[model samples]
Target chain A: MSVSALSRPSFSRRALLILLSVLLIALVVGMEQLAPLFRALFPDQDPAMYERESFLNLTLAHLALVLVSSLISVSVGVAAGLFVTRPAGREFEPLVSTLAAIGQTFPPAAVLAIVVPVAGFGFIPTLVALVLYGLLPVVQNTVAGLGTVPSQTLEAARGNGMSAWQILWRIELPLAMRVIIAGVRVSVIINIGTATIGSTVGAKTLGTPIIAGLVGNNLPYVIQGAILVGLLAIVTDLAFERLERRFSFGESGAMA
Target chain B: MSASHNPTRDTASARLVANRVLVTLLCAGLLAAWLLPFATMSPNRLASGQTVGLSEALSAWQAIALLALSAVLAVAALRRPLPRELAHGVVLLASLGLLLITLYSLGDYAQRTLVEKSPSARVSQGSAFWVMAFCCALAAIDAFQRASSGWLLRLGYMLIAGGSVAMLFASGHFDDLSIMREYANIRDNFSDQFITHLVLVGSALGPALLIGVPLGLLAHRHVRLQGTLFSVLNFFQTIPSIALFALLVAPLSALGNAFPLLGEWGIKGIGAAPAIIALVMYALLPVVRNTYAGLKGVPPATVEAARGMGMTARQVLWRVEIPLALPVMLSGLRIVTVQAIGLTVVAALIGAGGLGAFIFQGLGQYAIDLVLLGAIPTIVLAVIADFTLQMLVVLSKPAGTRR
Candidate 1:
């Protein structure tokens, strides 16, 4: 029953996904063409579009930042999660889990702000902040997902003469993949939002226009930036939904 | 059975010989103290400071005493079987002592050297101090975890440590520090901003609970509604908080313009209204999801038993289901409250007066201390909210179900 449900992409969802993607692309590519509309809305503001950098360039930059940071966060987070769960490193589990929980209580903005004093400004600090903030969800989910794998299954694999490494690679990881992917999805979405704030520290992202707009009180510019960012988030979320469903085999029900 | 137990006992004894986590942390702290600068002494607030090593910051005897205390901590951790509680006690006390001594010395150094030289001279904590402080905190937390399973014990420790720090602040020991100077400068409005931040969180939370609980209850009653409701809420959650705040500007302003009364009622584009609305929207997913899950989690048998006892549907829900679900629902509330506290900081971008105003203001002026002025309080608030709600969740567990 679940297998068939996983295979098919429902029509409305598929259409909505494509439609959002198209809209995002159109806005990115043709933001300038909407200037008259923006001007109509905000007559007091001159040059109603955010013209310092094109929307396409900003969107690409935003995605690139999130991509690099998410990649690093996932690998490092997953490694730490795996390490603490193993017999040789099991003693560190309490500390690692505690740190992950406490670290997340910090707001991402404050994390970014604090990093500035030590790492200085620009891309590296932004990257460091992103990875730091993004690490928590992935580590937590990886640990949680791996823990859900039954001990009996591990013993069964051992009975079949599989090495510890083989059991982890072939059985444990596959079983935990869905939860791990869900974590990655959350990390990516958070990074997308956080990357916008990266613009404040001189790492250019879609937030540039919005920040500039807020500072300058340019309503049109704010709207344009907000529209693109909102679309990107929705589109990315939909993509993850599809990916999560694909990995949902064997699980009784989908996790929200 | 004796033969099988022998190996397990041997391993347990081996484990007692060394706590590798604490040993590693102590070593790292010591290394950071030895290798990096302990503090920076700047002539004035704007100019960058020269780094001062631990040897420079404190006299040789004081530095040695500090290092000796750290070594004692490491040794105590290694001798884990010296009455397990005593070992943990030593670790905890040593770490706390190290922290207090380091800060006190730094403050003493700042008072005697920097402030005497120039009234405006600033002493900023350096990388080494931060690293040492972090290590001490983690070590203390680890020791506390090992020391007891009771929340009350942990709470006692927290209160002692927190009270000591508060007393230190009251005594003006850290007034020479740059961050403290920033605080002294903003002391007047600081409380106001802090109150504003709390108000913002409360405002958002009140509406969220009011709306989200019913939505969740509705979703629970109708399986079909659950799917659609969750999907819509999830969609709202996906939108970045910043973007959502900005996005609301257009329609909100238009609404205010159309109805002048809303503008008069403080429903403008770039203020508390949009910020609160976005926060409530972001909060709904956790609130609604948890409520629905909590209600659904009530065992059918329990509900049936309630009905069999001559209870009506409403009575069964209020008496049986809601009580059973309280913990889960409170956990969700915990998430919402913590998240709102953090998001409210970002709402400062939209001219909502809060601690984030200080943060952004400091960012604009390139003042790290000013940024800390805002960021520190924000973190403390979030942590407090998280801890308190976690306790509430634990307490809310139906008495029979609680561990």
Candidate 2:
């Protein structure tokens, strides 16, 4: 909302950060070249690390998994929430709430354990678990958002001859947009973190290095993998925060 | 679209409709249980199991009894002007009974089937049994919500139900099942892992509170610092638990090398040290956020009044701010304790020696029972921690203060 913040930074300044990050990532992916540096540090452990797949590929794969699962979770969670809030599906509110609560309370690791047998290993089971893990926030936010929509506003919409669907879309949803976005933010961020566990099931992600390091007692691999993952999480979170702020400000601007 | 919507009637009718749907779900879930396999019979633990449906495993009379009970619950759920308390009580009792009966009957069936068989044979409950258990839990929670009861009372009910099952379990009623067999095999190790899990959580909490409270107070005092502090903590939160664990190893190991005595004291890379460090890092956000929020929530007018009375800042903080903020702060502790309990299981992968050792071992062997031996207790621990901490938060609230 700050005018100074809205006045975007100069292109060169923005590009500097972007380029610096890119160069850093390049250095990491080509980290095998830095074996001497690693050897000087780790000394005892294997300095020449062999990550079969490139970090770029792993990062992309990890992000893709997060994206697909987050999308599914948001869609299903929001739809389920909307359905239960409707008169016909209202009875299902507690049932749906309980199901989501159980899904969340059950650790993602445990979910992986239970799901692996029926669904088999790799992406499907991991996706299933992540989606389930991600559902609670979206559903909770949707319910809270819809539940708090002022009755007077709904009545006004009805008085203006809007249909139920129209009121929900044009009035209720727009009003609840910020809350819904908050839910999606939470869900997606959670999926990003939880997705790291998918490496145990052999869905190659940034966790490959970390798991490999953990098993081999190779701290260098672990540090490299963890830094990338941690950075990704930070960058993604900041992006989401910026997106949320933009939406909030845009809505305020429209209102003004 | 009706303008003349009578809120009370609408809500009551909605409740009736919801009740009907829940009963339908219960009945359908029961039918699924009947149609699907109730347990699997494997020639050995490592062998692919054959499905044993309910009818194949249980007698016709047992099936009839279950069906009859299901019908009773369905009928009870549908009655007009539902007796909320009575219905809830019935639902609770019936669920507890059903779960016990199911477990006992399965144990009995396994014993009958395998008494003369090879020692390697394994009998495990199938997906149907799990689904039925889930449905029972769902229904009981729904009923519990409908019931107007205090936290202590609800907890007492849970204890009674849980304790009864534990008693039955201790009586060797479920020993024939593969899960219990696995538990029996590792009972001593199980206790040690449980203690280790508790210690990990307890140790993490001490440091978390020590650092988190001061950090929270600092952030609270300086508005500019709060944003950067929380963003850093939030960034820490978004890093996956395992990643955080992995990250801590290198630095911790270096520190250990620099200080021989610290290594002697178990401050190393691979074991509980890194695990506890990661947990403490993960815990700081909630504890800090909650502390800050709690302090921020104190009525400015009250603080003003205290200052007007010539109280020093520290005096106001200790005498006024703390008592007012204690409940919220405790709630934050509740969140972290529950979270830390669950996260500690992951710590076992690094030889931290918690329930996760069983879980990972089970995963390696593809033994679901062994996994359950660990996973179930972990869940139970988290739930108990959450419930107990929640009660503490409630109790700590000043008398007569509205929650």
Candidate 3:
């Protein structure tokens, strides 16, 4: 309980960033070196397919989808979580929980099929499904986080004459921020992984090359898709580690 | 007056009555709405534009009977503190009933000659049916556990309620199985491929449990290693499965190619083994994180007492720490497995034989039916795995879990 790491120098964060950037650089270098070999091997396939086309488009699309949907999902999930968790709105809690749980329990690919006719294929539907599938962790975490917020802190907020809204925005959210962040981190990571499936349905993302390569049995193309994805995931994860540190309490330092 | 503490007997009674009524109404409303498409006087004739034929009526009746049986089981759940064996029996019967209903419903839907015109009987065999049934089962389980009577009996009530919904659909499908010759999915000779899917899933669990459990245990014991272990594993998990599948291809293939002997035994570096290895990597974070968190969560005094009694470090961990951490580790395993099953689709890219092949196969061929054949089984396996793990988690909980 006494493990306050706040007094630590900020330089460690710079160190972390450098460490992560170097990792990224290394991957890029590796890819650059392999480019010639890959081209030599796949003269028949489009040369730029590995370079400017699949890898970059996939990573960007993945980042964009995850970034937008995570923001929307977390905002809505946290808000709904706050609303439904109140004593007066308690009964709705079960319904929300059920919906959230079910949303995740079903396969997103199957869900994509169901959503396709309704939402159409490609970006929006896949994005929407990702948002829905990603909603549970943040919302559940919010509910549980707020639930576990110290009673004394809540009482202090009330004693200070903060309105319910203020208490939530100021006292509760901040205290629960770490937990909520943990939830968001989980959602973000899962979304990164799940985003690959978007290609199977033709979103023009990185998964397309992977899926296409799989079907065609092209090893270099497959490696091109996979390496980029794995690299992006690692990079994005490192970014989150930094973000979590800046906003969260003392535990952020411990988190990485 | 503090409302939670307004302990007057009359107040408790009134509250109980109100709750019971609400539960009943909500349960009925949801269940009925879910089944509404099935309950028509005339059956839906998707193929012929005809009303439900008489034969369809018979299946519908059986569905209704099955539903009633489920409801009756829920009612019986009102009976208190069910005997240990009886509780197990009810769970089994309800499960059996649900299975029977699905088999029957599948039969009816699959059978072109079955003369069933009602979509209700057939609908329960699909996605909506699964969703509705799962919801009902949850509600029943909640109500049963929370019932004013014994905990076991309350749980039984819930099981019965859920079981009935599942049965209605299952039996509805099963009875019509004989008629379903035309729409049969794949000539999936269940001998090898089925075993392959199971094996892939099973093997993924191998490295997962092996790597995850030790890391979990080690991270739990060593404070210094915790952050590094957690971050590394978390980073490992953050990589999307699709990417991981693709990423491992060349290196593994290169290794296999470099070493001639490795390539022959299905170890030619790139496909199945790499897929399994990557799947294991994907599954590791949850196990380790949960195990670490679970172990760290052990009461400080408990560990202190174990040490005071001159217990060796090994003794303390094996005897005290693990028993307590079992639930968390098991849950972690569950998450890993469900995740592995779903993510296994990525393996298809590498010729790691799996159901994903059909899904991707369908995608390429533009065959919707083939996609469903692959996707449906994966979903079912995920759900089934989730529930089985849930049962394990519930059963393994330390107190008030003997039921």
Predictions: Cα RMSD each: 2.6, 3.5, 6.5
Error of 2 at A245 (Å): 1.7
For residues B1-403, what per-residue lDDT tens digits would candidate 3 score against the true structure? 1321342224544433323322453365346435533212212212212223223533676667557756644543443545434553554455345444534444444454435444332322333344334544554443333332454554564466447546654554444431121124355542355567778889989978888888878876677786667767776677787777677776777777788787887666556788888888878888888888789888999999999999999999989998988888888988888888877765765677677776666656554445666676777778778877877877777986554
Highest DockQ among the candidates is held by which one? 1
What is the C-alpha lDDT profile of model 1 across A132-183, one tens digit per residue? Answer: 9999989998998999999888878888998878988999888888889999
> Which residues of candidate 2, in runs, are more than 4 Å off?
A1-36, A249-256, B3-18, B81-85, B308-312, B401-403
- Would you list the rank order by TM-score, best first? 1, 2, 3
Query: Per-residue lDDT tens digits of candidate 2, residues B1-403?
Result: 5423532235565556437655765876778787888999998877878999887888777777777778767766865545756777887777766776677678878888888888888899888888887777777777777775677778898899789878988888778888888888999999999999999999999999999999989988987676558767877788888888888888888889999999999998889999998999999999998898899999999999999999999999999998899999998998899888888888887779898888878877777788788888888787777778878888888887633
Local lDDT at A78 for model 3: 91
lDDT, candidate 1, at B183 = 90
> What's model 3's TM-score?
0.76
- DockQ of candidate model 1: 0.56
Worst 10 residues of 3 chain B by lDDT: B39-48
Cand. 3: chain B TM-score: 0.67
- Please write out the lDDT profile of model 1 over residues B1-403, one tens digit for every residue: 2321243234754566567778879889889989999999888887898999988889776788797897788678764446778888888888888888888888878777863677888988999998988998999988877875577677788888888878888999988888888898889899999999999999999999999999999989986676568889999999988899999988898899999999999988879899989999999999999999999999999998899999998899798998999999999999999889998988999988899898888888889998888898999999989989988988898666554
Candidate ranking under lDDT, highest first, comes to 1, 2, 3
